[model samples]
Target chain A: MAQARQEDNATDAPPEALRAEGIVKRFGALTALSGVDLHLRKGEVLGLIGDNGAGKSTLIKTITGFHRPDEGQMYVDGEPVSLRSVAQARALGIETVFQDLALISELSVYHNMFLNSELTLKPFPLLDNRKMKERTKQYIDDMGVNIPSIDTQVGRLSGGQRQAIAVARSVYSNAKILLLDEPLAAMGAKEGAMILDLVQKLKNEGQVSIILIAHNYSHVFEVCDRVNLLQHGRISYDKPTSESSVEELTELVVAEYRKARTTS
Target chain B: MAKQAVGGDVGASESARSSPGLGSRVAELLLRQREASIFFVAIALAVYFQSSNSAFLSSGNIRSLSEFTYATAIISGGLVMLLICGEIDLSVGQAYGFAPIAMYLADQTLVLPVAVIVGLLATAVIGLINGVATVYLRVPSFIATLGMFFFLGGVNVILTDGFPKTAPSGSFLTEILGGADWSGIAWCLLIVLLMHILLNRTRWGLHTFATGGNPVGASEAGVKTAKIKVGNFMLCSALGGFAGVLDALRIGSIDPLAGGPNIMFFAVSAAVIGGTALAGGTGTIIGAFLGTVVLSIMQNGFSLQGVSAYTFNVILGIAILTAMTLNVYVGSLRRSGRV
Candidate 1:
């Protein structure tokens, strides 16, 4: 079935933004991921759903180069690549917004926006704060993210605002493939809505391909173009969102729980 | 619930925009700036001392006051940076004690300039060891540096045989480094200024802040947090050594017991009183300089007033407690945006 899908992908479809084939990861006596295959198409949002400890985080970490799979062939833009570090992955325009959002709260919004990739003055080894602040303000405003001021410390901003800034930082850095891990996990309805709006806007632009890892089936259906269910370290179900429903996804997950109950 | 959260954020920002009364504004400014409040306290103490003892502000007394302030100021400047980057060197004072002895021993075999370099290199190596132990060996820096403190203290006594040694005489280097009346303060101000620039304007400083603010986050963003931390430890120890050499040059003697835990405590206290958080991620070199000034003023003022040494310690303890309490209170006020 996976081979047939790959043939279909090769014949007629949008180009693959990223593809992982036969990925396997092991830790000591435990196997976290065993022969997992996943594909993300260009400019599409793929919702990745899995139960806790189903190797969801491990897979994301592997793809982001925070982990090295024992066996895998990963391709970026149809070109095979071996990623050794997060910096190398970033060099290839792949960015991950982890669950914690990876923001330094003591730093100002502009500073956080340009944290590691700071702009420096040409003549001196000094940060160009003025230019960075100005550009951050313009970029944030253009994205329609409501921040009090660019100079405010990120810790002072609301969670939703902080998440927006994280997403914006990734987008601003020209990420071609953005992976968001639980972007709306603990967010309120309004804040979740805000993030959904931002994702929808990015989807409309169709420039950055995204893989959103979420637990809520409704959230997955809201913005995802396709859904991939990870179970027992494999993609158990892959279908377009238009061809699937929340009830179907829930039943698939519940059936696993029922099987475990009977076997135990 | 969501509406309340959003409304709360908007309300806080809105209140920040709306002006309060003039009195509250000034109060707010002082509360927001740990340095400004401490500077005022330093000035107030100076004024009181001058009024009580007419000789307090005399040129002779001023020179002595600066002599006391320079060593602490220079050491605290480095401590501020270290603390901001989420590390500390309890052995800095030992580095201070060790450098002059190293310089003195090296002066017998090498040029004075070469000997000074050797002295600084010795301290830098000590810093490197501290960094290595903390970063790679996974030792907590507090315990690592404390162990270094005791280790170096013993090394200092062994090196000097528990006796003071006279610094090399009549070199022009001494005159410029610390022998001249104003040279110590000159070096102090210059170092403080450079440290201020390094902390506020440079990319290294920004990375240092980021590394301390959130180590995991900073590393995820590709910031070399381990390098930044190790580099800060080296810089702190180097500065401590520099201050020790300067004092030895000025006094023409190196005491094995001098610049030990007392000086280290003073430097740490000054940095904290100046607004450097012990939890790290925030600090100011200029604030640390002002903090040194406050400490120096209290010590000088009490001595001029004929206060006993024991009584001065009592006052110093009380003063630290008061300053820190006020710092915490003011910090909360600033966070809540209520002065």
Candidate 2:
């Protein structure tokens, strides 16, 4: 797989799996992302942190191709490309788990897993629900997930289970780069820990890269190899977690706040 | 106790034990599959009518009732699918009469088999138009088909010049398509079973359910929601045309003026009464079949009891409302985490 990806990305290649530079998005009078540059390495988790309206979500959206940047260049596996739609991004192995999770709550777990990519038999080529159900069991077990029934509707699962299923869907879709937007938001303390462990497990597998957005600084520090802080639609802080402490990131935010107050 | 019974999770007793079961799990399961109550209600009505009238349960009476309903039931199968895909085609009623008239017009110049083929193809084209208008033109299907309902009704008058067309008869095909030759029931049952397999066992069926359940979610997951909806529209009209031809052949003439919005309404109600949803994303073919059966039984009972036509209409209206209310209520309960 590594050799094939390298061969396909022989031209205009960058070392990172995904790279974005000078991304600027404007909404008439308001600018959502102003010249933001971010890069994700292979099999590494990058924590994205920001205050309210800090452009973190905007950057994630741009990366997932939900919103196109007015001025920017994006590269997938070293090849420069422009994505016009989320479907296009998915084709290039980019998957995003939005705050809403984009889940059909009324459908079964197995059905949702193969929502758009259902297995079909030859000749007649009808949906292979039995196979999908069996595969869903395998995927969940391999990921150490504890869903009660693969055939049960996703709406019946607990909040964290729902979040995990959404994350699992992205992983199971063969996503090369997974973007999670506040997956732990409003989750119970135990559920939050459970998801963190799952993310850590995916990280250990070393198959897909991760970009996680979270409000909790400690959780970010716990799971992220590196962290980026978005401020006023630009990435203001990028540092390795080993070299930077949570206290230091907190101080940077405080300093930025004081500077804003002084200027105002 | 009841809820757990309905939400039975085999091999997972811990969670089931932790949560109190309030509603009958059996009732809940019955509602989800949408079979138990409709079947029960139909049987109950059948029993009630049998007790009241000596002829109600007679084999001849039952067979005749089925013969009356087979065409509409066939059309309802298609409506059940379309409704599940979150759309409707009111033009079906017109297509039913229109196809036979087209067949009659073509038969004047061509052979019977060729004329029949032309009629079916023409109806398929109309169905394609309905699908394209709704999907590509971005017009809501309800309004687009409503326009078709009126436009096609006007076309019926223009085609036969305001007179019932004398249909060419005594053909083997007509006997199979309609007539009291038992072939009509066989064809209807064959279509119903084929449709049931398509909805439950095919990828197309899964896509239909996904498209209706959540279009955005389905699209994001890579489903072609618009395509599925359009396909269902065509399926609905084609079946509507087929049913129309059957009814015309059985009655021995084509009456454009006789069938209007009423037939389409009856078919839709039959689907809903059986447990197919009006709001989409949920339905069953068996339920729709049962629904048509119940309506047929009720209509037969009313006429036998010597009820006036106007009184029977009121009673039928009440029946539709009660069935729809029950359907919607069961739906809401399911959404609240029972099934």
- Top-scoring candidate (lDDT): 1
* Per-residue alpha-carbon lDDT of candidate 1 for residues A1-264, written as tens digits (9 for 90 to 100): 434644677689659999999999999988999989999998889999999999999999999998999998999999998889998899999999998998998889999999888999988878899999999998898788899999898888888999999999999999999999999989999999999989988988888999999999999999998999999888989998878999999999999999999999
Error of 2 at B168 (Å): 3.2
Candidate 1 lDDT score relative to the true structure = 0.91
Alpha-carbon RMSD, each predicted model: 3.4, 5.2
Candidate 1 at B287: error in angstroms?
A: 1.2
DockQ of each: 0.72, 0.53
lDDT of 2 by residue, B1-339 (tens): 977776675536667656746666656666766777888888998888888898997888877887767878888998888888888889888888788888889999999888888887777777788888988998888989999989989998899998997777786777767865666778888999999999988878888888777777777677888889888887888888888887788888888785678888888888988888777788888788888888888889878888777887897799889988888887778778655
Clashing pairs in 2: A14-A78, A127-B203, B1-B21, B1-B22, B2-B23, B2-B24, B2-B25, B3-B23, B5-B25, B6-B25
Sorted into a CAPRI-style docking class, model 2 comes out as medium
Of the candidates shown, which would achieve the greatest TM-score relative to the real structure?
A: 1
Per-prediction fnat? 0.81, 0.60
lDDT per residue, candidate 2, A1-264, as tens digits?
544544554564436879999999999999988899988888879999999998888888788888989999999998898989888899999999887776777678988888777899888888788899999899999889888999888877888888888898899999999999998999999989989999999998989999999888999988998899999998888887777888998999899889999999
Q: In angstroms, give how far residue A4 of model 2 lies from its true place.
A: 26
lDDT by residue (B106-156, candidate 1, tens digit) is 999899999999999999999999999999998999999999999999999
Error of 1 at B158 (Å): 1.6
